[model samples]
Target: MPDNGDLRDVESTPLQDTGVRVFAVPPAEGAGPGEIMQGFLEALTSDDPEYDTARKYLTSEAASAWRPERSTTVLANGPSITTDCVPGGREETNSATCVLTGTQVATVDAQQAYRPAGGPYRRKLHLTKNPENGQWRIDGLPDGVVMGKSDFQRNYRSVDKYYYASGTAVGATGQPAAVADPVFVRSKVDPMTQMVRSLLKGPTAWLGTVVRSSFPAGTALQKGVSGLAPDDQNKVTVPLNLKASRVAARTCSEMATQVLFTLRNLAPTLESVELRGAGGDRLCELNEEHAESAAWLGSARSPEYLYFLDGKRRLVRMPMRSTGTGAVAVPGPFGDGGRQLQSAAVSRDERTAAGVGNGGRSLYVSSLASGGSLGDPVLTSAGASPADRLTTPSWDARGDLWVADRDPHRPRLFVLEEGASEPEPVAVPHLSGRIEDARVAGDGVRIALVVAKGGKRSLFLGRIRRGGGDGQETAVDGLRSAAPDLEQVSAVSWAGGSRLLVVGQEQGGVQQMRYVQIDGSALDGPAPGALPGVKAIAASEDERAPLVAYSEDGVVRLPSGTQWQKIDKEGTAPVYPG
Candidate 1:
């Protein structure tokens, strides 16, 4: 991969030597405070599931209280540590405490969900000599572990866990609508146990509102087992408590499927997921065949072509599923008139499109295949200047069009449902600035809003909650900061059910693109590499799909295993089906 500098810092050197580390086993005895401190941090990057070896550095009391499962913090770099003798000289004059500090880059919770840290983190390590062994051991410290970002990237991995949407009735579609919430977990840890615990804990706060877990409330793993184990036959059994026993056979099977799919990526061994009661009775077994058959909760149905506007200011499409090139102007009334298109969004079905016209003063919709206008300006701005007018338009899976009328005096976010004469205003509670663009996820329950404030921009994730039932217009209940780490977010797109491909500049840094979870945690992987001079970007639910963007070279796409290739040398505003 071409070097693009740190995704979070353009002016700084990129972190190097990200290969997996080989940690030496801790000393059998006589290790000092400094040695223990180093061993402890190294253990965070080790492949040990339970960190059994790292416990040797701590006193018996401290070891029993430390819980590495509480969290895994990714620091900007290896922490700086300093030690000094305790002022009052106890029985052992060599007794001392160590102070360590580092900038926290991100944090992964016990559920494995990743969240970027907002500031620096500091830790204290108190140590005393183990009189019996004459070894300086840690007597007190923080509960969890911390490691450098580069080391964290090499040791951790991002995985998705499946959950069904909330509003969908069970079995409405042979496959219930499923959304994937991505989380980061240690690659060598007992990932199966982590995945199970995450599933039982339900979705993260941001996703909790839109998706529901199959596991029952208060369901938990049987105590006394620190990690899961597989039988000689390779069948891994999951032991659940009594709360899960209340579920019906079919419900239990669905729950098993959730665990099946989530663990499928982590452990590809040959077998099934057997859900067991606390007493060891089998509740249900979800084999590979059964998991494969339950496809309702997933998404892989996007169109094969990416839609954009050609040099002639006309709507066009190019094949995305192939290595082919060239663009075909979609049959439509757009770009046919003296009209000039700014930015546009294609509906999830690819049947219709919403476009910003006349320098963002008006919004219009037209049929893509039928070649006709759906209506006269679905929305128009009363603002005077072009910058104070409407922004790009986007469509959600529910067939509703979303746009922001950035009238300086009356900035508003509006949603236009099919056949609605006037767009209904969607309230964005506690908006810090003017709305620049709005893109709704394919699930139709969340929206990614870019707000410009104080000469800078930031991205926020919001839930789409409708008030009136039936055919009433729905509104955005609230928006929460999605990528609080990115100080000047320029563009964003839903890369997966739980992850977003965000292009933004870090505070006082150059712009770059990275995959970030809705909870504001950057993925513990290599940067998507930089898109030089990129203006906008779009991605599909398939993480493997090539990203299409508009740059100085015109509409371009970074195809797999290749550099950016031009689709239309003179086009702008490239977009894909959400």
Candidate 2:
């Protein structure tokens, strides 16, 4: 047992926030082989300028060859080190090899994008002793570096590198369609540089076909400068290589948008961006207004209101951006019906609604405005009992409604396109379970599904491929685990273009919430604030929209705040327009 007094400190202290944290190096005086190895590992977490200090623990040849910026391997647990000395292997008659092993948590690419790498990590370091000073120094090792998760969090920050979505252009409604590619870069290093470099490199593997960058092929920073750094005036000057020098004036502004948006989260106080060529010639200057004007190129504006069902089973709305407002039922058939909804979703146009009945056996669709009359069930489940009926309904930007009929004997997932009379079945191969819930991404290209298998629930990301006769039919190409580490996934929602806010529990743990990339990598930052007794979860495509959920206390919304605030005394199936 632990002290109750000490537990308070742990409970009250929040997780590490986004900021620079400098890691210090201990004195190496009279350090043995083991001490030298530990010091070398710790030095990897130091800022770029302090990397010279890391070289101190390495031999001259090894120090010059090692490049910490090449890649970063993150471990789930602290590294275990074991050394073996060989008096006869080297001419110095004193050499040792230190083996480091741990379960790899993830790896940050040269572009700085973080991708899940769930497996074992093994590395070896060859060390030699300097007879004169009796100092043990690393003689040989791998090119990159590895560190534990805690240290990685302390040294790196997760930031979304923004890029225009496929086919998205200016004048688009809401936010520009942008897919967020979360990457990890050293907090103490030059994040602006990392972001710019990664943007030039383009989106990650899985998202490659879905998003495109503004930078031209072979575009890169100037040879001498590794990254862009802010000046005294909060102006960041980006020096591009010769490949980018031929860009036209209009294209330069678009290029500036990419850089500005990507660096916004990192340098929030940034005032302007200066584009330059290899020879120090100015290409363009984007002031604060220019950045602000183009910021929504690939993102969405915050939603106006959060919607859910009230105690009377009426659809209601809660103002998300303002305070001092009461929950008002939506005007129309949705609010007029005495119908009780177990789960529901609103279309992107905000004119239509799809809901699952209390027993989940009946699915209904109704117009959200007054003049429209309540209709009969739009779709029904084949389940014989309430527990085996339908899951929550979700709407995508294309006006397609998605839901899963949780019939264990005849489990199926369906999508109802606009103006369609009957829902169409989508094949989900390798689904060794029944579908619990499904949320389609705004682009209508991806779907997040929660499947229950062998008494355990799991979340999977599936790519939807539309092609069948008239191209109306859709099927999941394949299913990949997005929450492989969770014991059970109860709820999930698309938080952004390629990120999902998932509610699940780790092995042997209680329910918790966290943000994960579509590729399955966890987001970097404070664990998403949790809402106690939450039964369902919903989020808008706009990342800034408040997170809505149904809890024992009624309807709760987690705005850009640290705590969950109740909005309604009783509600369920809270959802935002897709």
Candidate 3:
């Protein structure tokens, strides 16, 4: 909202594109915090980017030192970011300064964990515009608990199309970008009796299921992927590719099934590009070549929730109303009093809901039949106020709610059982810094995963059982698994409790939509052919069909043994007419 000759402005990042003005840089290339402050003060009332001032006053190192890190990636997601912006008119001097309200961590070892990278901490700053740079770059680092640094936002997708954010590496030419909903193509592994018999035929047969034949008669495949034809130049349809064949193999540790998903370009050269994915455990990869698209611009069961990166995809959380009142509306979604459809978690029966967002807290239930008309937001803890925030929530087989407690300094994961009096914290490695994100499995028996200080990320599993003199936190199953493209696991959901969709930070072309599933007990026929364009993964009551929404693609439905298809849209684009 720092408006000035400022040149130009936008949301999230990249306020302006104009180059910096010519000026002398600081004598010290690696100047400290104070020096950076002094130079910024002098550059007040300048054009945006203020390239000239940095050139004249700051050494290349001093100027570039102002970059934001990974931990602070959410800073732009201000505690209270107003959609409205205020224009500049008031005269400024020493009364104002810019503030970075977040934390940072090192990707290396621990010793450096104590070091504060950069931020406003929790203190407010009085900022002034540089008539020259047209920005209010911090004169000095504000005050607060410094966490860590260098998170992976640049590689992350979900960008706003109307106004491109800076730091985005679009194409090799670095030109404008276009997209379609992300598609979630899944290969069923936990095989039914029939599946086991099919696989007996061998590898080629299994591979066929990964890509398979064409769309069925009167199929929505082509229309869903490309949308109404060339008449609408806005059309975006990219091909799908399966580079590796996904298989459920038993690890040296246990008999488990895992599925791996990487960013595979289904399109021909110019039409295709690479993207990033979530960072965490590695799973099996399904390699084939029948692409699908999920658009994010529809409502309810339809393809809505358009993401800048993926085209048409559908992912909708039921209303907070009783499964009886499933007809409720979600305005702007969060922020206001209206109900919000956060991430979804299907119960074994698919009757209960464990989503975290507006209106609802820990877990809520709506009849899958009536879609739970209940309008109350369910909270796991009932002690009035426990001084914690619930986010990225999930559920287990017992209908127990698994949620991560969001606290910069002392974060923990909570378990809310069906009839338990209160939610309890299963001890986790305490991080003096910040606990960014957490997720749980479908069975609800496995341990929770957390991303903490330093790029040194690890998974913690199991209960704090005591055996010897000193009690040690035991290791649970499936924790700290390595991922290919994800910077940090951003989102997690259970697809049949064993299979999962872990959304992470984007980087390079490797991570547009990647997922891994866990299955061990082999039943029968080789899993269903491929299901594509899935952004976020969730399970259905019968396990017959899986609900998926591409981070960029809107929403889609993958039936038991058929190719992917789109569900008709119900809600219109909140921003424009569909």
Residue-level lDDT of model 1, residues 1-578, one tens digit each, is 96776666458787795646566487456665677787777776788767877887788898899998888888888787855434254655657788988888878887677877758788878887866767788888887888898888777888888887666432334455566777877765676787788888898766777788777788898986656756667677888895434879878878888887787667667368888887788888878777656645324555677888888787778777867777777767764644688888887767777778888888988877554755678789988988789987877655678889999899999988752447988877778899988887766678888899998788888887764677655666557788776888878888877778888988788889888777665555676656688888988876667988888888888877778887777889888864
In model 3, which range of ten residues has the least summed lDDT? 252-261
How does each model score on lDDT?
Answer: 0.76, 0.75, 0.31
lDDT of 2 by residue, 192-287 (tens): 776787788887766676567767778888776765777889888898884344878766776777777678778888778888886778888897
**TM-score leader:** 1
Candidate that would win on lDDT: 1
lDDT accuracy of residue 168 in candidate 2: 39
The residue-level lDDT of candidate 1 at 87 comes to 26
lDDT of 1 at 106: 79
Worst 10 residues of 2 by lDDT: 168-177
Give all TM-scores, in the order shown: 0.81, 0.80, 0.33
How many residue pairs in model 2 have overlapping backbones? 4
| Two-way TM-score contest, 2 vs 3, winner | 2
Error of 1 at 296 (Å): 5.7
Ranking by TM-score: 1, 2, 3
